[model samples]
Target: MEIFIVVLILLLSIVISNILSRLIPFVPVPLIQITFGIILGVLPTGIHMPLEPELFMVLFIAPLLYNDGKMTSREELWKIKSPVFLMSFGLVLATVLIVGYIIHFMIPDIPLSASFALAAILSPTDAVAVSSLSERIHLPEKIMTLLEGEALTNDASGLVAFKFAIAATVTGVFSFANAALSFFVIAVGGFLVGAVLALIIARLTAFIRRLGLEDATFHVLMQIISPFVIYLVSEELGLSGILAVVSGGIVYSLQSDYSEPIISKLKFVSRSTWSVLIFIINGLVFLILGLQIPDVMSVIFRDDTISNFKVLMYIVVISIVLILLRFIWVYSLWNEKWSVNESIEENPNRFLNSLLTSLAGVRGAITLAGAFSIPFYLENGQYFPQRDIIIFISAGVILLTIFIASFVLPLLVKNKNIEADKNSSKLNQQALKSVMNAAIRLINDETNQENKLAASSLINVCEKIKNDNPIDKEDIKLTIEDRKIEKDIFLLGIRAERKEVRRLLSDNKIPPATYEKIDNSLTKVENCLSKPPIIETLNRMDSIKNFISKFLKKQLNVNPINIKDIKKIKVLTSKAAIYAIKEQINDTNKKASLAVIDHYNDIIRRLTTFTIGEDINNVNKQRSKLHLKALQAERDQVQSLLQNNEINRETALKLRNFINYMEATAIEEQSF
Candidate 1:
């Protein structure tokens, strides 16, 4: 139970951090999460969660790498493959060698092997952290892609080096030639193993389908578990599990069926699942780092050999050295022009770009995980030399890198475009309007009476979306009279719905629970109509609004309604509201009154369909099909618009996603 509570608390912190990051967009999410973890560390329920390297890799790294591999564009990766390889492998090796010596020279107490291990741990750059930093400002597409690709492969290279260093430290042996040979075997072997396993899995799935067994969710689940399965298998075979998962993801993407509807659905589900899984895992990594900080720092501070000030200096020096090394490496690569998408002639400021890239090499999860993974005890049964201090320094480096990147990168690369965003929003509304119109056309053409009636109700819904989505500021400007008419009609409609609910509840047609739910909903709408205010102002406003209602409450002393009357109550009340609007309607308010009347009439139609409860299964099936067809029409229209350049890719994507959600909701409703 305590364990369960701890898990809940950690999860709650992640949620709170997510909220804080959104509310404070300038602050990166990982920083917020780390802060929360720091706060939790000082609390009574301070968590000291163990960080096992093998478990961490399997749970977080493998799947995340797999997803990244799957999503990376093969063409784009191919274009900059050389740069990516150089940075991921070459730069990583250089950083480990160069930084390792620097650390050893600075802190002679830490052995050279231990220093190399720490260096290896910090070698890999975090694309995720860079992405978080880039949320507000877009990095050059060329640099972003290069960073992403480097991050993908460097995890394997850096960790492989760390493994070698750790092994040397444990057994008191070191050989560069043997390690290089072993790396080649492990990398190639892991790649082959993952590719083979993915092919086997894909073939097995096809065989199952040939046997007339088809389930998208089942296939998607298999895909979800593939990384873990591949990782374990590769590790068992004495190979690189990281490379295996990466290759497995790439191979799986190649074998996927792109044109099939079921495959599309599976992809959607898989993407959503991976997105959520990666987010939580990524968040927990930083959170756990923050939790571990206090313990790591405490050990370092308590040591007689090292002063707290020296430790701080070590962190600052190491962090600065790493950044300088990165800047030098990036600067050297500029001779090749880094195969950037933009021409050098167009954006000739190469030095600035290199510096931005250098700043962007932010260390994150892998670094923290590797530091913690350092064995507590050596092979001779003695505690690993300066293990806590090593972890502490590594943690400090991660924090400094992220901190620097968050504040520095935005200033270096200015990509925020307010006008572009506004234009995109207008385009999104245009796409939505086009799609809704297409859907309305399809529903109007339906021949089946019941299907038409059920789907026809959605036409108003589509129209409302179109109307509410104003394409320009001028379209949203409403006159005082118009606002007054809208407010009055909304209040009257709410009162009618409330009256119906009370009449039914009093006659025992709906139980107390249902009445309470309905009453609460009506109260919410009323509250929205009149904004919350101070007690005196609120009371004054309520008195004015309830004057007529107070007299009507006294007149509610009437006979009980029958079951048949209850069945017709909603439709009858909607009609009553419409009639009341018409009675109060004048030439000046005709447009506003008709708009409200249309909404009430929609409620009547929906109620009428609900009252036809007989043959519900058939009705539901028809409704589902119609809903899906309408959504399909919307999707087709979006595609057409994209092809015509009526909307940009981003706007079309948003519209398609909106339609996809509605389609998913319809399918979910049908399933239930």
Candidate 2:
């Protein structure tokens, strides 16, 4: 139970970090989570949860790497394959050899193999730490892609090195040939296993969907579970679980079928789930890292194993060595105008790009986790030499690298010139036209009066923006009036549609999965409605009240609320009072009926529109303007609910991401 509570605290650490990141943009998220985790570690209930090597590799590293592979464009990775693979494999191997020698030299008592293991632990550059660069900076696409690819693959390479190093340390012997052979088998076997698992899942999922058995709940659960399954299986097969997960994710991503609307909706849900899950995992990784450090500290300081000051010095020296070697290696590779992408001329500033790449090598949670997992005792039963010291030094290097990447990387980017995306404007224009075409199609195909009215209005608005055709003032007003009518009728349509879905479910015409998917959309729309039903009713009631008051003041010569009938209602058990109340009600009802009649009867000349729902636009502008705003509005509603703690984080992120994709579509449409 204490372990469970400690786990919850770590999860809370993730939440606290996100809120803190918003407050302190200068401090990176990893630091914030880690700092808070440290604070949590000091509490009375603080439970030490040390990571075991197998568990850390499976639970934390595998899924993260797999997701990284899934998100990364295979085409982009291929283009930068030479650089990325070299960095992932060759650079990792080189770092292990050099850092092993350096650490051994710094502390002669530490065995050479143990030093190599320490080096391997710190080899993988953290992708999560540098993820924001794509959103924050207009870095050369190729450079970012190369770095990301290295991040995805380097863990496997580092783990391979670590495996060999640990074996040498345990057995008191080393073999270059055996190490090389093991590395090849592990890497190759892991990839193949992942691919095979992914293919099986793809076929199974598609079959399930075809049979209409693929509920969004099930789809999302399977996706989240598959990485773990792949990892464990690969490990059982004497392969790298990290590589297996990565390959499975990438393969499954490519193999996925989201052709059906229901399937597509489920896919959206899964993506959103993954996004939020990733965020929490990222937070936990760093936060738990901070928690583990104190335990490492206890081990180091409990006995006079090494001077704390000397340990700090070793950390500083080792971190410097790692950074300098990577920078020198990357710098050496950038002589000519390297061509990765034809459209993106990223090689113009080769020197600067290399500098940025080198600086971006931030060590992260993986390093710390690996350090913690170092065995306390070797195979011979003697204590593992310098285990505590290795952990302390690794922690120091992680912090130093993160600080450099967070603080210094931005400054380097700031020095570079940023160019406007000329191509973006052209893309936006194309998107506007597509919306225009969609509008035209809607107008032409739909028999409904409201859709046509909204579509026509959208077309006119789009034409004016495009300078293609000018619409008359009368037509514009009528279109706007049509939209107002559509808003008024939208709820009625929603209720009716909901009734139909329920009816189908009761009659067994549709499967529960289908019902669920459709009903979920309906519920989301209902939850996200800007105005509640009662509010709309109250708005109408207010109008009715005002109309009655005006009529009484002008025609009956009395204030409506203060009239004799209304005043008599205050008398208890009076027949006249009851009669008066009835009269007041009748009068109010009459006025409301008259006002509603007037509202709908107002003739908008030469206008046609859908009253049930307004098509915000029939033109290209709809994508960027009206429809885009609607998507944002729905997401905003979800966000507000999430902020008020009305919905769970999982639900909030799922809804927000679905809306987000629509917004992205709009942005993309406009871009093209």
lDDT of 1 by residue, 593-626 (tens): 7766876676567556665555654566677778
Report the C-alpha lDDT of model 2 over 119-189, residue by residue, as the tens digit: 99889988766663333333555677777888888988997898788888988888899889989999999
Candidate that would win on TM-score: 1
Badly placed stretches (over 4 Å) of model 1 are 127-140, 257-259, 335-349, 376-383, 413-672
Kindly report which residue stretches of model 2 are placed more than 4 angstroms away from their true locations once superposed. Answer: 1-4, 132-138, 257-262, 301-305, 335-347, 417-630, 633-672
The collision pairs in model 1 are none
TM-score per prediction, in order, is 0.69, 0.67
Q: Rate the local accuracy (lDDT) of all candidates.
A: 0.73, 0.64
TM-score, cand. 1: 0.69
